[model samples]
Target chain A: MFAVHTEDLRKEFTLKKGLFERRTAVAVDNISLTVKEGQAVAFIGPNGAGKSTTIKMLTGILKPSSGKAQVLGLDPWRQRSRLVRQIGAVFGQRSQLWLHLPPKDSFELLAEIYSLDKKSKQYKSRLEMLIERFELAAFLNTPVRKLSLGERMRAEIAASLLHRPRLLLLDEPTIGIDVVARQRLRELLAQWNREEGLTVFLTSHDTGDIEAVADRVILINHGRVIIDDTIDGVRHYGAPKSADTGEPPDMQSLPALEKVLSDLFTAK
Target chain B: MLKTAQKLIAVAKISARANLAYPGEVLGRGTFLLVVLYIFLKLWQATYSESGQSKLAGLSLAEMLWYLTITESMWMSAPKLAQQVDEDVRTGSLAVKLIRPLSYPLYCLSANMGERLVRFSFNLALGACIALALVGPIHLRAEALLMLALSVCLAFLLDGLGHLIVGLSAFWLEDTSGLYLIYTRLTMILGGMLIPLDLFPGWLKNLVVYLPFPYLVWGPVHLLSTPQAELAASFLELAIRQLACLVALSALVALLWQRALRRVSAHGG
Candidate 1:
């Protein structure tokens, strides 16, 4: 079964120009795509490309202007409460942590919010695994306000996973972090996708994130999907050929891949 | 249903904990409460002597000062709920809240109540000490204290609902601060924060009694000041009015929230 399926999805926002005047902006314009269960797909686009709008629609935070969307075989707009239980999201710019409290408290509160049995074996094991995997034990009791951005984001991801969601939606999860922390996050995400078979829907401008985590790349521009292909396909589709082998540049490393993707985006 | 309640309670607990994280700020607020209580005590003293009555509106100068203390503490402890909601809406952080499985309105209500409870406890404690120093202790009954406790809880819930209603108006209004200012001022004047309802002209008191404002402050505080024998009867009447207001405000909040959902245009990526 598909984890996410949308058919001709659209979202238009109305703006008030002045008294007795209104303008309609099409944010997500008739986009249709699907991600099979456990597929790690990257949703990338330039600003105002409606990537966020599409994510919002799928998360049931905003109603679509038209078309159909089913998440986990449930209608997002009509059955958001139920759908939200099976899905988790991390918007890098927005925090779910209580700023004044430690991550431990936030995690405890989240366990309650998700109605997880705190004393259950499953809950205990999941918490232990997340703590170990996310490297959260060191600062778990430190207040969120005092934690470094990297620590907080690690905690944020761990908190989202506490419910054992089948699908995870991440928006720029590695943005604004040091290189070491960024690589660690990317590795963790890729590991989660590979081992847990979690369906990952990531949106990021960082090519390193795309290279390390996403298996498939779905690029959108002006509210429509422009390209959908495997990461290697995307890398070689428009990349400059090498003088030595008449093949794409050796974009095996982070910096080289980043330059290729940057060139691709610029060419688009 | 039980699970929902537990979720709300958890949210409240976390909010309370977060509010307590900054002891210096809470203590700063306590200092301000001390000053306000002192000012009210002096002003009420002057009013009592000038009137040449030991009691005005059936309250001795001491009871009057005590009443002011309770009302001021309640006012000072109010969480900036409307402003928080306004910020959430304006900044698009509301989207983060909506993604959660819990109802957004209930989550907000719980958080507000939690913060308010902690702040109110601190303010009331300090205010009580100041009141004790200024006017000595007024005669009190155990039953009156129980009634005060119950009514105060209901009052906070009712007031939180009112703030939620104002905050939800942010979906349409360019800004909610003006609306919040007006709402609070109305509560202060009509809710009898500055003066007891008993002191209002008979017509004004009668009018405000029919509104929710009086129930938020006057009704609850009045229950504490009532004679012991009448405490039960006053509480019964006040509880009924408060429940009725709760029902109406809750319905309005539900409606506003449903409409607000459709208007959500999350601001940024």
Candidate 2:
């Protein structure tokens, strides 16, 4: 079974004015997609392009106006609490941790929320492993308010993973971090993807985040999927071909990848 | 049920620990509330002297002062659930909260209760100091005091639920602070925050007693000042009314939260 599947899901919002006037906005139009288990899918789109909206619907934060979505064979909206138990989510700009307390406290609180056996050896080792893997030992005791954006993001991801979720959904996870921090985050996510076979559904605009971590790319615009292909297929699109033989464009240049994406973003 | 309790306790504990991080802010607000109490003491004393009555509406001067102290402590230290909910909804941060395996309203209620309990303790102690300095000591029977504590705890839940209802209006309205301000004023006058209900005209007192607002502040404060002989009778009557209000308010929260969830889903957050 696919880790994620949606069939023509849609969401409509109505806005009302002072008197009798109303306007309807279609945030997520008829959109259907699927992700295989352990697939690293990068959902890239422009601003206001329904990427986050789709993720929200799939994660049960929002209910679709029409159609259906099943994450791990369970209806996302109907089984939200149960679904959330097996899925992790992180929003780069929003925090789930208490700002005034250390990440250590947040983690403990999360453990309780997830009903983990904190005294068991397996849970203890897993906690230690995550701490070590994320390199959170140094700043784990510091208040979240005092941490830099990058550190807080890392901590947020760590806390989300304490439940050992099978699928991880990230919304703009690398939006505002420095180069080194972003690179580190990308590497850590890649490791989780490769070693643990964790299914990842990520929404991001950053080319580096997509290139380094995602194997499959789904480009969306105006509430519809424009392109769904492997990274190689994406790289090959709109590149300069050899004049005489109509050969595939060279993939070695970084500019060619950026050009292809820029053209795709600007295309009708 | 046990696991749910454990999780809620953890949530509350974390919230309480977060509250401890802002000692200076707590102290500043506590001091400000103490000043308000002192001013009320002076105002009440002058009003009694001018009226040339040793007692006004069934309460002695000292009893009235103590009643004000209890109500003010509750009012001043109540959690800002409405503003917090409004901000969360507006900023879309509430989406993060929704994904957790917890009810958003319950989480907010638990967190608010934890923080309010801490702040209430600090305010209660400070108000006691001011009350003693101004009105001298007012003796209380142990049973009446116990009943007062029970009523106040229920009042906190009732008040918090009321705030939640107001806060959830943000799901439909653009802002809820204005509504909360109105609610606070209504609760103050109609709920006996500013003056005892007995002091009000009989018709007005009777009408106000039927609403949940009276149970929020007036009921508890009234019990706190009741004589020991009548404590049992008064406590039983008040408990029944408060429980009825609690059930009704809890139902309202459940219904409104369900509606808010629909709005949130439609709006893509």
Candidate 3:
């Protein structure tokens, strides 16, 4: 079964004003896409392009206005708890940990929330070992609110992965993170992707996040999927060809990837 | 089941520990409330003396002043559920609460109750010191005192009900401040936060007797103001009314919670 799928997915919201104002917003316009099992799909869009809205819908945080979607062969809105257990999520720029609690304690709370087996994942030992792997032992007891931004982001990502879920959904997971932190996160994600073959669906404005992590790209604009292809396909289909032997533009430069997105979205 | 309760207790305890880190703010608010209670005591005493009646509305000058002091402190510390709900909606933070394997309303209730219990202890000490220092002693007969304790507990239940109703408005209205203001004013007038319930016209008192508003202050004030012999009969009647209000309010909370969750799943914050 497909790990994630959506058919004509759409989300509309009504403003709180009078009927005469007739203000309606189509946060996620009718869009369709699918991700195969164990595939890493990156959903890339501009700030107001309904990327977060789509993630929220698939996570069952919201209901689509008109569409069909599934996560891990289950309807997320209909079976939220069961579907959520199979999927791990980390919303960028928002720390789920209690501001006053230590990073280790926050991990315990996350473990309890996910109901991970205490016998197997004894929180203290497991969380400490996980932190050690990330070179985070020196900041073990520090409160999350007091930690540096990079360290805190690492903590957030670790907390989200404690249950070892098969599907990971991250929204803008590396927006303003430093190079070192981003690199660590990228390595961990790659390890999870290669060993566990975890399926990841991510939304990011940063192309580096997409390039370093996702194998396939899904570009969205005005709430619609304008292009869905591999990183190489994005270059061939969405960018101009180089003069050298009529080859496609080089894809290594980050700004070049962004330029392709801007041109495509602007054209719409 | 036990584990969930333990986790909730841990949450409550940890919340308390974190809040204690900011004791200075608590002390300041307590002191300000005490000062306000003291001024009201002097003003109420002068009013009674000028009236020249042995009792005004069946309460002695001292009894009336003490009642005001207690009610002022309690009402100021009313449950803050509406503001919490408003904040969750405004910040899109409610999504975090929803993803957890817990009922959102229960979470809010436990947190609010734990915080209120802490405030109850702090304000009690501070208000008692001011009351005793300014006015000698508050006379209480055995039955009146017993009913007085029961009445305070009932007031908390009533306050929770009021907050639940107000907070549920957030599902529809973008803000609950307007609803909160209306509820507060109604409680102050009908619940006898300003004027005593007995001082209201007989028909008006009869009308509000069954309402939760009166349970908030009317029950406590009447218990504190009346003698032991009079309170014995009133206690049985008031207890039944408060019990009914609690049951009805709980059912209302459950209904609203279902509606709110349904809306949240279908719509964005």
Candidate 4:
């Protein structure tokens, strides 16, 4: 079964041009895609490429202008309350943690919000697993306001996972962390996707994030899917032909991968 | 239904804990409360002396000061519900809240009430200390205290709904500050925050008594200062009015909330 399926999903926003003039701007235009269960897919796009719009529709934050979307076999917009219980999302630019409270407190509140019995064996085991796996023990008691960016992001992701959501949507989850921390986050995400059989839908401009976490990459631009292929396929597409040997540039190096992705974005 | 209540109560507890995280802010508010109570004491003392009356608006000098103390504490303790909602809408942070398995309006209402309760408690404690030092103690009755507690809780719910109504306008309005400012000013002036409703002219008092604002401040505080015999009788009448206002405001909030959801563009991607 597909974790996510959208058939010609579209969203049009009405833009007020003036006192009397109104124009319709298509944000996600006739986009069709599907992600298999437990598949890790990176939905990447340049700014204004409607990546967020599609995610919003999939998560039932906004109703599509037309077409249909099903996440975990449920109509997202119609069954949002039920769907949300099975889905976890983290918007790196936004926060779900209370700024002034410690991560532990926020996690406790989230457990209640999700209606997980605090004393149940399942809830306790899951919380313990997240705490250990996320390496949150050292700073769990510290207020979110005092935690470093990396520590905070780890806590944020752990908080999202508290309910054992089947599908996880991460939008730029590693946007502003140092290299070591970013690599650690990426590794943990990949581990979760692999070991837990969790479907991962991620969006990030950073090539390293995509390379490390996604098995497949879906590129969208101007409200349409421009390219949908395996990570290797996209990497090869970005690799430039070397002049001396008539061979493709090395896709292994981070800089080389970044350059290729940059070329692809601008070329498209 | 019980589960929903549990979730809301959890949110409120978290919010209250967060509000206490910054001790300096709470201390600052308490300090401000002291200055305001002292000023009220002096101003009211002079007003009574000039009028050549030991009582004004059926309240002794002590009762007037106590009444002002409650109103001032409430005014100072108000959580910035409308502004917070405005920021959430403007910044697209509301999107994060929407995906949660909870009602956003109810979550917000719970959080607001929790924060307000904490701040109100602190302000009232400090204000009471100042009132005691300045005007001595006013007569109190056990039943009156019970009535005051019930009335204050209802007032918080009603006021939170009022703020939510103003805040949800952010879905349509570019900014809600102006509207919130107007709402608060009306609550302060027409709600008898500075003076007792009994002191207003007969026609104006009659008109204001029917509005929700008076119930938010005057009614509950007045109950606290009332004599034992009259407390039960007035409490019943005031409680009924407060409940009626709560029903009306809650309806408006529910309606506005539904409309607001349709307007959620989640602008900043």
Local distance difference test, per candidate?
0.90, 0.87, 0.75, 0.89
Candidate 3 per-residue lDDT, tens place, B126-239, comes to: 777777777767777876777877777777766866787787778888678999999888888898887788788999988987678988876775776666666777888888
Give the 10-residue window scoring lowest on summed lDDT in candidate 2 chain A. Answer: A240-249
Cα DockQ of the candidate 4 complex: 0.71
Q: Write the per-residue lDDT of candidate 4 for residues A156-219, one digit (tens) a residue.
A: 9999999999999998999889999999999999999999999999999998999899999998
Query: Could you give candidate 1's per-residue lDDT for residues B11-77 as a string of tens digits?
Result: 9989999999999987898788788888888898899889999998889989998998899999988
Candidate 1: misplaced stretches above 4 Å? A240-268
Better of 1 and 3 by lDDT: 1
| Per-residue C-alpha lDDT of model 2 across residues B73-145, encoded as one tens digit per residue | 8888788898998888887888899988888988888888888888778888888888888888887777887
Reproduced native contacts, each prediction: 0.75, 0.67, 0.20, 0.64
- Sequence-dependent TM-score of model 2: 0.96
DockQ for all candidate structures vs. native: 0.77, 0.63, 0.31, 0.71
Candidate 4 chain B lowest-lDDT run of ten: B260-269
Per-model TM-score of chain A alone? Answer: 0.92, 0.94, 0.89, 0.94
lDDT per residue, candidate 2, A1-268, as tens digits? 6999989989777778668999987888888899999999999877877887888888888889999999999998899989999999998788999999999999999999999999999889989989999999999999999998889888999999999999999998988899999999999999999998999888887888998899999988888888999888887676555432566555574245567888888888
Lowest summed lDDT window (length 10), candidate 2 chain B: B260-269
lDDT of 1 at B124: 89
Q: Would you give me the overall lDDT of model 3?
A: 0.75
